[model samples]
Target chain A: MKKRDHKECVSALLPVKDTLDLIGGKWKLLIIISIWEGNKHFREIERSIPKLSTKVLAKELKELEMNKLLHRNVIDDFPVRIEYTLTEHAKSLKTVIGTLHSWGLTHRKAIFEK
Target chain B: MKKRDHKECVSALLPVKDTLDLIGGKWKLLIIISIWEGNKHFREIERSIPKLSTKVLAKELKELEMNKLLHRNVIDDFPVRIEYTLTEHAKSLKTVIGTLHSWGLTHRKAIFEK
Candidate 1:
Protein backbone atom coordinates (compact mmCIF):
# COMPACT_ATOMS: atom_id res chain seq x y z
CA MET A 1 0.00 0.00 0.00
CA LYS A 2 1.01 3.62 -0.48
CA LYS A 3 2.34 5.48 2.53
CA ARG A 4 -0.73 7.71 2.65
CA ASP A 5 -3.10 4.74 2.56
CA HIS A 6 -1.10 3.05 5.28
CA LYS A 7 -1.37 6.13 7.46
CA GLU A 8 -5.11 6.28 6.95
CA CYS A 9 -5.44 2.62 7.86
CA VAL A 10 -3.56 3.12 11.09
CA SER A 11 -5.56 6.21 11.96
CA ALA A 12 -8.84 4.40 11.34
CA LEU A 13 -7.79 1.44 13.43
CA LEU A 14 -6.51 3.36 16.45
CA PRO A 15 -9.98 4.28 17.62
CA VAL A 16 -11.10 0.72 17.09
CA LYS A 17 -8.26 -0.35 19.33
CA ASP A 18 -9.33 2.23 21.88
CA THR A 19 -12.93 1.06 21.74
CA LEU A 20 -11.96 -2.55 22.21
CA ASP A 21 -9.73 -1.72 25.13
CA LEU A 22 -12.61 0.06 26.78
CA ILE A 23 -15.18 -2.72 26.26
CA GLY A 24 -13.30 -5.93 25.50
CA GLY A 25 -14.32 -8.54 28.04
CA LYS A 26 -16.71 -11.40 28.60
CA TRP A 27 -19.22 -9.38 30.59
CA LYS A 28 -19.09 -5.66 29.81
CA LEU A 29 -21.24 -5.61 26.68
CA LEU A 30 -23.60 -8.13 28.16
CA ILE A 31 -24.10 -5.92 31.18
CA ILE A 32 -24.59 -2.94 28.95
CA ILE A 33 -27.20 -4.81 26.91
CA SER A 34 -29.01 -5.89 30.02
CA ILE A 35 -29.28 -2.32 31.24
CA TRP A 36 -30.27 -1.19 27.77
CA GLU A 37 -33.08 -3.68 27.80
CA GLY A 38 -34.40 -2.21 31.06
CA ASN A 39 -32.60 -4.18 33.72
CA LYS A 40 -31.75 -1.05 35.64
CA HIS A 41 -31.45 -2.47 39.14
CA PHE A 42 -28.54 -4.65 40.19
CA ARG A 43 -30.59 -7.73 40.91
CA GLU A 44 -32.43 -7.37 37.63
CA ILE A 45 -29.20 -7.14 35.67
CA GLU A 46 -27.88 -10.22 37.41
CA ARG A 47 -31.00 -12.23 36.73
CA SER A 48 -30.93 -11.25 33.08
CA ILE A 49 -27.48 -12.68 32.54
CA PRO A 50 -27.85 -16.25 33.74
CA LYS A 51 -24.21 -17.21 34.27
CA LEU A 52 -22.57 -13.92 35.29
CA SER A 53 -21.42 -13.83 38.87
CA THR A 54 -22.39 -10.93 41.09
CA LYS A 55 -18.73 -10.01 41.66
CA VAL A 56 -18.01 -9.88 37.95
CA LEU A 57 -21.16 -7.89 37.33
CA ALA A 58 -20.20 -5.38 39.99
CA LYS A 59 -16.72 -4.97 38.61
CA GLU A 60 -17.94 -4.57 35.04
CA LEU A 61 -20.53 -2.03 36.17
CA LYS A 62 -17.85 0.12 37.76
CA GLU A 63 -15.73 -0.11 34.62
CA LEU A 64 -18.66 0.89 32.41
CA GLU A 65 -19.34 3.84 34.66
CA MET A 66 -15.72 4.89 34.53
CA ASN A 67 -15.82 4.71 30.75
CA LYS A 68 -18.95 6.85 30.82
CA LEU A 69 -21.08 4.22 29.15
CA LEU A 70 -23.44 4.12 32.08
CA HIS A 71 -23.94 5.89 35.37
CA ARG A 72 -25.31 5.23 38.80
CA ASN A 73 -28.27 7.00 40.31
CA VAL A 74 -29.03 6.72 43.98
CA ILE A 75 -32.61 7.35 44.96
CA ASP A 76 -32.54 8.36 48.58
CA ASP A 77 -36.00 7.19 49.36
CA PHE A 78 -36.80 5.38 52.57
CA PRO A 79 -34.97 2.30 51.29
CA VAL A 80 -32.15 4.00 49.32
CA ARG A 81 -32.49 2.40 45.92
CA ILE A 82 -29.72 2.66 43.38
CA GLU A 83 -30.27 2.26 39.67
CA TYR A 84 -28.07 2.20 36.61
CA THR A 85 -28.89 3.94 33.36
CA LEU A 86 -27.12 4.33 30.05
CA THR A 87 -25.70 7.76 29.46
CA GLU A 88 -26.43 9.48 26.15
CA HIS A 89 -22.91 8.44 25.23
CA ALA A 90 -23.74 4.88 26.08
CA LYS A 91 -27.03 5.08 24.23
CA SER A 92 -25.06 6.00 21.14
CA LEU A 93 -23.80 2.44 21.25
CA LYS A 94 -27.24 1.19 20.25
CA THR A 95 -26.33 0.97 16.58
CA VAL A 96 -23.07 -0.77 17.27
CA ILE A 97 -24.76 -3.10 19.71
CA GLY A 98 -27.57 -3.78 17.28
CA THR A 99 -25.13 -4.62 14.53
CA LEU A 100 -23.31 -6.96 16.87
CA HIS A 101 -26.59 -8.60 17.78
CA SER A 102 -27.45 -9.19 14.13
CA TRP A 103 -24.01 -10.38 13.15
CA GLY A 104 -23.94 -12.57 16.22
CA LEU A 105 -27.10 -14.34 15.16
CA THR A 106 -25.68 -14.93 11.71
CA HIS A 107 -22.38 -16.14 13.12
CA ARG A 108 -24.11 -18.55 15.45
CA LYS A 109 -26.17 -20.01 12.66
CA ALA A 110 -23.15 -20.33 10.40
CA ILE A 111 -21.15 -22.13 13.06
CA PHE A 112 -23.81 -24.45 14.36
CA GLU A 113 -25.30 -25.47 11.05
CA LYS A 114 -22.07 -26.01 9.22
CA MET B 1 -40.34 -7.31 32.36
CA LYS B 2 -42.89 -9.88 31.34
CA LYS B 3 -41.90 -13.53 31.24
CA ARG B 4 -42.12 -13.59 27.44
CA ASP B 5 -40.01 -10.47 27.13
CA HIS B 6 -37.42 -11.91 29.49
CA LYS B 7 -37.19 -15.06 27.40
CA GLU B 8 -36.75 -13.06 24.22
CA CYS B 9 -34.08 -10.96 25.88
CA VAL B 10 -32.12 -14.00 26.99
CA SER B 11 -32.42 -15.61 23.58
CA ALA B 12 -31.31 -12.41 21.87
CA LEU B 13 -28.30 -12.19 24.15
CA LEU B 14 -27.09 -15.78 23.94
CA PRO B 15 -25.66 -15.34 20.44
CA VAL B 16 -24.13 -12.02 21.48
CA LYS B 17 -22.48 -13.89 24.30
CA ASP B 18 -21.22 -16.38 21.76
CA THR B 19 -19.97 -13.58 19.53
CA LEU B 20 -18.13 -11.96 22.38
CA ASP B 21 -16.59 -15.25 23.43
CA LEU B 22 -15.35 -15.67 19.86
CA ILE B 23 -13.94 -12.17 19.41
CA GLY B 24 -13.65 -10.48 22.78
CA GLY B 25 -10.02 -9.52 23.15
CA LYS B 26 -7.73 -6.56 22.59
CA TRP B 27 -5.90 -8.14 19.67
CA LYS B 28 -8.27 -10.38 17.69
CA LEU B 29 -10.38 -7.72 16.01
CA LEU B 30 -7.33 -5.56 15.39
CA ILE B 31 -5.56 -8.42 13.69
CA ILE B 32 -8.65 -9.18 11.65
CA ILE B 33 -8.88 -5.58 10.52
CA SER B 34 -5.20 -5.58 9.65
CA ILE B 35 -5.63 -8.55 7.37
CA TRP B 36 -8.82 -7.12 5.98
CA GLU B 37 -6.81 -4.05 5.08
CA GLY B 38 -4.39 -6.28 3.07
CA ASN B 39 -1.68 -7.12 5.57
CA LYS B 40 -1.81 -10.80 4.68
CA HIS B 41 1.67 -11.88 5.69
CA PHE B 42 2.48 -12.48 9.34
CA ARG B 43 5.09 -9.74 9.47
CA GLU B 44 2.89 -7.27 7.62
CA ILE B 45 0.08 -7.91 10.04
CA GLU B 46 2.46 -7.41 12.93
CA ARG B 47 3.67 -4.10 11.52
CA SER B 48 0.15 -2.78 11.09
CA ILE B 49 -0.86 -3.29 14.67
CA PRO B 50 1.50 -1.41 16.92
CA LYS B 51 2.55 -2.98 20.26
CA LEU B 52 1.04 -6.37 19.35
CA SER B 53 3.41 -9.11 20.36
CA THR B 54 4.21 -11.84 17.82
CA LYS B 55 3.07 -14.55 20.23
CA VAL B 56 -0.28 -12.83 20.75
CA LEU B 57 -0.82 -12.24 17.02
CA ALA B 58 -0.09 -15.86 16.21
CA LYS B 59 -2.46 -17.00 18.92
CA GLU B 60 -5.22 -14.68 17.79
CA LEU B 61 -4.77 -15.76 14.17
CA LYS B 62 -5.18 -19.37 15.12
CA GLU B 63 -8.26 -18.54 17.15
CA LEU B 64 -9.80 -16.56 14.30
CA GLU B 65 -9.16 -19.47 11.97
CA MET B 66 -10.72 -21.88 14.40
CA ASN B 67 -13.80 -19.68 14.53
CA LYS B 68 -13.99 -19.75 10.69
CA LEU B 69 -13.38 -16.02 10.40
CA LEU B 70 -10.09 -16.49 8.56
CA HIS B 71 -7.86 -19.17 7.08
CA ARG B 72 -4.22 -19.77 6.27
CA ASN B 73 -2.76 -20.52 2.86
CA VAL B 74 0.73 -21.65 1.99
CA ILE B 75 1.96 -20.70 -1.46
CA ASP B 76 4.32 -23.13 -3.16
CA ASP B 77 7.40 -21.01 -3.67
CA PHE B 78 11.13 -21.21 -3.06
CA PRO B 79 10.78 -19.94 0.47
CA VAL B 80 7.21 -21.18 1.06
CA ARG B 81 5.16 -18.03 1.50
CA ILE B 82 2.17 -18.08 3.84
CA GLU B 83 -0.76 -15.72 3.75
CA TYR B 84 -3.94 -15.21 5.73
CA THR B 85 -7.24 -14.21 4.22
CA LEU B 86 -10.70 -13.47 5.50
CA THR B 87 -13.22 -16.21 4.89
CA GLU B 88 -16.51 -15.10 3.36
CA HIS B 89 -17.81 -15.64 6.84
CA ALA B 90 -15.22 -13.25 8.16
CA LYS B 91 -15.87 -10.69 5.44
CA SER B 92 -19.40 -10.58 6.78
CA LEU B 93 -17.88 -8.88 9.78
CA LYS B 94 -17.17 -5.82 7.66
CA THR B 95 -20.28 -3.97 8.73
CA VAL B 96 -19.79 -4.95 12.33
CA ILE B 97 -16.21 -3.80 12.24
CA GLY B 98 -17.14 -0.59 10.45
CA THR B 99 -19.78 0.20 13.03
CA LEU B 100 -17.22 -0.41 15.70
CA HIS B 101 -14.76 1.88 13.95
CA SER B 102 -17.33 4.66 13.70
CA TRP B 103 -18.56 4.26 17.25
CA GLY B 104 -15.02 4.12 18.51
CA LEU B 105 -14.22 7.45 16.89
CA THR B 106 -17.29 9.02 18.43
CA HIS B 107 -16.49 7.46 21.77
CA ARG B 108 -12.94 8.71 21.79
CA LYS B 109 -14.05 12.24 21.00
CA ALA B 110 -16.77 12.10 23.63
CA ILE B 111 -14.41 11.10 26.40
CA PHE B 112 -11.60 13.42 25.42
CA GLU B 113 -13.67 16.50 24.70
CA LYS B 114 -15.67 16.37 27.92
Candidate 2:
Protein backbone atom coordinates (compact mmCIF):
# COMPACT_ATOMS: atom_id res chain seq x y z
CA MET A 1 0.00 0.00 0.00
CA LYS A 2 1.28 3.43 -0.83
CA LYS A 3 1.85 5.88 2.05
CA ARG A 4 -0.25 8.60 0.42
CA ASP A 5 -3.09 6.13 -0.19
CA HIS A 6 -3.27 5.43 3.55
CA LYS A 7 -3.70 9.12 4.34
CA GLU A 8 -6.49 9.36 1.78
CA CYS A 9 -8.30 6.45 3.39
CA VAL A 10 -8.15 8.06 6.81
CA SER A 11 -9.29 11.39 5.44
CA ALA A 12 -12.30 9.73 3.85
CA LEU A 13 -13.28 8.36 7.22
CA LEU A 14 -13.25 11.70 9.03
CA PRO A 15 -16.81 12.56 8.04
CA VAL A 16 -18.07 9.20 9.17
CA LYS A 17 -16.48 9.79 12.55
CA ASP A 18 -18.01 13.24 12.75
CA THR A 19 -21.45 11.89 11.99
CA LEU A 20 -21.02 9.25 14.65
CA ASP A 21 -20.01 11.92 17.10
CA LEU A 22 -23.25 13.75 16.36
CA ILE A 23 -25.74 10.92 16.70
CA GLY A 24 -23.97 8.27 18.72
CA GLY A 25 -24.29 8.45 22.49
CA LYS A 26 -25.81 6.65 25.43
CA TRP A 27 -29.00 8.72 25.43
CA LYS A 28 -29.09 10.91 22.33
CA LEU A 29 -30.85 8.50 20.01
CA LEU A 30 -33.20 7.41 22.73
CA ILE A 31 -34.14 11.03 23.23
CA ILE A 32 -34.68 11.48 19.51
CA ILE A 33 -36.85 8.40 19.29
CA SER A 34 -38.73 9.35 22.38
CA ILE A 35 -39.50 12.73 20.88
CA TRP A 36 -40.49 11.02 17.67
CA GLU A 37 -42.78 8.79 19.66
CA GLY A 38 -44.46 11.93 21.03
CA ASN A 39 -42.77 12.95 24.19
CA LYS A 40 -42.59 16.73 24.00
CA HIS A 41 -41.58 17.75 27.46
CA PHE A 42 -38.60 16.96 29.62
CA ARG A 43 -40.82 15.16 32.13
CA GLU A 44 -42.43 13.15 29.41
CA ILE A 45 -39.03 12.04 28.18
CA GLU A 46 -37.94 11.26 31.69
CA ARG A 47 -41.09 9.25 32.13
CA SER A 48 -40.51 7.31 28.95
CA ILE A 49 -36.91 6.36 29.68
CA PRO A 50 -37.37 5.23 33.22
CA LYS A 51 -33.82 4.06 33.75
CA LEU A 52 -32.12 7.19 32.45
CA SER A 53 -30.95 9.58 35.09
CA THR A 54 -32.32 13.12 34.83
CA LYS A 55 -28.83 14.55 34.44
CA VAL A 56 -27.95 12.16 31.63
CA LEU A 57 -31.18 12.82 29.77
CA ALA A 58 -30.71 16.57 30.12
CA LYS A 59 -27.18 16.35 28.82
CA GLU A 60 -28.23 14.20 25.88
CA LEU A 61 -31.08 16.54 25.04
CA LYS A 62 -28.72 19.52 25.16
CA GLU A 63 -26.30 17.76 22.85
CA LEU A 64 -29.03 16.85 20.37
CA GLU A 65 -30.21 20.45 20.42
CA MET A 66 -26.61 21.52 19.86
CA ASN A 67 -26.32 19.09 16.95
CA LYS A 68 -29.49 20.57 15.44
CA LEU A 69 -31.41 17.35 15.62
CA LEU A 70 -34.03 18.71 18.02
CA HIS A 71 -35.86 21.92 18.70
CA ARG A 72 -36.31 23.01 22.27
CA ASN A 73 -39.19 25.34 22.98
CA VAL A 74 -39.60 26.86 26.35
CA ILE A 75 -43.18 27.50 27.32
CA ASP A 76 -43.33 30.25 29.85
CA ASP A 77 -45.52 28.83 32.53
CA PHE A 78 -45.46 29.30 36.25
CA PRO A 79 -42.89 26.51 36.54
CA VAL A 80 -41.20 27.21 33.18
CA ARG A 81 -41.75 24.23 30.88
CA ILE A 82 -39.68 23.08 27.93
CA GLU A 83 -40.92 21.10 24.97
CA TYR A 84 -38.71 19.32 22.48
CA THR A 85 -39.56 18.35 18.95
CA LEU A 86 -37.54 17.25 15.97
CA THR A 87 -36.31 19.97 13.64
CA GLU A 88 -37.00 19.54 9.94
CA HIS A 89 -33.49 18.28 9.47
CA ALA A 90 -33.89 15.96 12.40
CA LYS A 91 -37.30 14.92 11.13
CA SER A 92 -35.44 13.85 8.02
CA LEU A 93 -33.46 11.34 10.05
CA LYS A 94 -36.63 9.47 10.96
CA THR A 95 -36.47 7.20 7.96
CA VAL A 96 -32.86 6.34 8.54
CA ILE A 97 -33.21 5.63 12.22
CA GLY A 98 -36.44 3.78 11.65
CA THR A 99 -34.64 1.62 9.14
CA LEU A 100 -32.00 0.94 11.78
CA HIS A 101 -34.74 -0.22 14.15
CA SER A 102 -36.11 -2.51 11.48
CA TRP A 103 -32.63 -3.83 10.80
CA GLY A 104 -32.33 -4.65 14.49
CA LEU A 105 -35.54 -6.61 14.37
CA THR A 106 -35.04 -8.54 11.15
CA HIS A 107 -31.28 -8.79 10.80
CA ARG A 108 -29.71 -8.57 14.24
CA LYS A 109 -28.43 -12.08 14.91
CA ALA A 110 -27.97 -13.83 18.24
CA ILE A 111 -24.48 -12.55 18.91
CA PHE A 112 -25.67 -9.54 20.82
CA GLU A 113 -28.98 -10.89 22.01
CA LYS A 114 -29.38 -10.16 25.66
CA MET B 1 -55.45 11.15 28.64
CA LYS B 2 -55.62 7.89 30.51
CA LYS B 3 -52.79 6.42 32.59
CA ARG B 4 -53.04 3.16 30.66
CA ASP B 5 -52.50 5.04 27.39
CA HIS B 6 -49.32 6.55 28.72
CA LYS B 7 -48.08 3.15 29.80
CA GLU B 8 -48.82 1.74 26.37
CA CYS B 9 -46.89 4.56 24.74
CA VAL B 10 -43.85 3.90 26.91
CA SER B 11 -44.00 0.18 26.21
CA ALA B 12 -44.13 0.81 22.48
CA LEU B 13 -40.88 2.81 22.87
CA LEU B 14 -38.92 0.12 24.68
CA PRO B 15 -37.72 -1.55 21.48
CA VAL B 16 -36.55 1.76 20.10
CA LYS B 17 -34.61 2.30 23.29
CA ASP B 18 -32.99 -1.10 23.00
CA THR B 19 -32.03 -0.52 19.39
CA LEU B 20 -30.49 2.82 20.27
CA ASP B 21 -28.42 1.09 22.91
CA LEU B 22 -26.89 -1.17 20.25
CA ILE B 23 -25.58 1.30 17.66
CA GLY B 24 -25.41 4.55 19.59
CA GLY B 25 -21.82 5.18 20.56
CA LYS B 26 -19.03 7.59 19.77
CA TRP B 27 -17.02 5.01 17.86
CA LYS B 28 -19.27 2.08 16.92
CA LEU B 29 -20.80 3.46 13.72
CA LEU B 30 -17.53 4.97 12.55
CA ILE B 31 -15.77 1.67 13.10
CA ILE B 32 -18.51 -0.16 11.25
CA ILE B 33 -18.28 2.27 8.35
CA SER B 34 -14.49 1.98 8.40
CA ILE B 35 -14.74 -1.78 8.10
CA TRP B 36 -17.23 -1.36 5.29
CA GLU B 37 -14.82 0.96 3.50
CA GLY B 38 -12.32 -1.97 3.51
CA ASN B 39 -9.85 -1.94 6.30
CA LYS B 40 -9.77 -5.45 7.78
CA HIS B 41 -6.75 -5.75 10.02
CA PHE B 42 -6.32 -4.25 13.47
CA ARG B 43 -3.48 -2.07 12.27
CA GLU B 44 -5.43 -1.19 9.17
CA ILE B 45 -8.43 -0.15 11.24
CA GLU B 46 -6.14 1.83 13.49
CA ARG B 47 -4.69 3.43 10.44
CA SER B 48 -8.10 4.22 8.97
CA ILE B 49 -9.45 6.04 12.01
CA PRO B 50 -6.38 8.14 12.68
CA LYS B 51 -8.06 10.41 15.22
CA LEU B 52 -9.26 7.47 17.30
CA SER B 53 -6.97 6.35 20.05
CA THR B 54 -5.65 2.81 19.75
CA LYS B 55 -7.29 1.75 23.02
CA VAL B 56 -10.67 3.29 22.15
CA LEU B 57 -10.65 1.75 18.67
CA ALA B 58 -9.69 -1.64 20.09
CA LYS B 59 -12.48 -1.40 22.63
CA GLU B 60 -15.04 -0.35 20.03
CA LEU B 61 -13.91 -3.17 17.72
CA LYS B 62 -14.25 -5.69 20.52
CA GLU B 63 -17.75 -4.42 21.30
CA LEU B 64 -18.73 -4.69 17.64
CA GLU B 65 -17.27 -8.19 17.50
CA MET B 66 -19.22 -9.07 20.61
CA ASN B 67 -22.40 -7.62 19.12
CA LYS B 68 -21.79 -9.90 16.12
CA LEU B 69 -21.52 -6.84 13.92
CA LEU B 70 -17.91 -7.70 13.18
CA HIS B 71 -16.10 -10.97 12.61
CA ARG B 72 -12.56 -11.09 13.92
CA ASN B 73 -10.16 -13.41 12.12
CA VAL B 74 -6.88 -14.38 13.66
CA ILE B 75 -4.01 -15.21 11.37
CA ASP B 76 -1.52 -17.22 13.38
CA ASP B 77 1.89 -16.23 12.02
CA PHE B 78 5.13 -15.13 13.68
CA PRO B 79 3.18 -12.18 15.06
CA VAL B 80 -0.49 -13.16 15.11
CA ARG B 81 -2.51 -10.74 13.03
CA ILE B 82 -6.22 -10.03 13.46
CA GLU B 83 -8.66 -9.00 10.77
CA TYR B 84 -12.18 -7.69 11.18
CA THR B 85 -15.07 -7.81 8.80
CA LEU B 86 -18.79 -7.17 9.08
CA THR B 87 -21.04 -10.10 9.82
CA GLU B 88 -24.15 -10.72 7.72
CA HIS B 89 -26.26 -9.07 10.36
CA ALA B 90 -23.91 -6.12 10.39
CA LYS B 91 -23.85 -6.07 6.61
CA SER B 92 -27.61 -5.61 6.81
CA LEU B 93 -27.09 -2.33 8.60
CA LYS B 94 -25.14 -0.94 5.64
CA THR B 95 -28.16 0.26 3.73
CA VAL B 96 -29.54 1.97 6.80
CA ILE B 97 -26.31 3.71 7.70
CA GLY B 98 -25.57 4.57 4.11
CA THR B 99 -29.00 6.06 3.82
CA LEU B 100 -28.17 8.05 6.91
CA HIS B 101 -24.99 9.39 5.30
CA SER B 102 -26.94 10.37 2.21
CA TRP B 103 -29.62 11.91 4.37
CA GLY B 104 -26.97 13.98 6.08
CA LEU B 105 -25.72 15.18 2.76
CA THR B 106 -28.99 16.01 1.11
CA HIS B 107 -31.32 16.90 3.97
CA ARG B 108 -29.34 17.92 7.01
CA LYS B 109 -30.19 21.61 7.54
CA ALA B 110 -27.72 24.28 8.63
CA ILE B 111 -28.44 24.16 12.34
CA PHE B 112 -25.42 22.00 13.03
CA GLU B 113 -23.25 22.99 10.13
CA LYS B 114 -19.58 23.55 10.74
Worst 10 residues of 2 chain A by lDDT: A1-10
Candidate 1 local lDDT, A1-114, one digit each (tens): 222224545555787877787778788888888888888899999998979999988899998898888899999998999999998888888887888888887786676558
Q: Model 1: iRMSD?
A: 1.5
Residue-level lDDT of model 1, residues B7-112, one tens digit each, is 4455557767777877787888888888877889999999888899999888899989988889899999889999999998778888888888888876776765
Per-residue lDDT of model 2, residues B1-114, tens digit only = 232224445433555555556676677777787788888887777766657789998788877777778888898997988888888777777677776676644543354444
State how far residue B82 of model 1 sits from its true place (Å).
Answer: 1.2
Summing lDDT over every window of 10 consecutive residues in candidate 2 chain B, give the lowest-scoring window: B1-10
Name the weakest run of 10 consecutive residues (lDDT summed) in model 1 chain B: B1-10
Clashing residue pairs in candidate 1 (N, C-alpha, C atoms within 3 angstroms): none
Q: Candidate 1: what lDDT?
A: 0.81
The local lDDT score (0 to 100) that residue B49 gets in candidate 2 is 67
TM-scores of all predicted structures: 0.88, 0.80
lDDT (Cα, 0-100) at A9 in candidate 2: 46
Name the runs in model 1 displaced over 4 angstroms. A1-11, B1-11
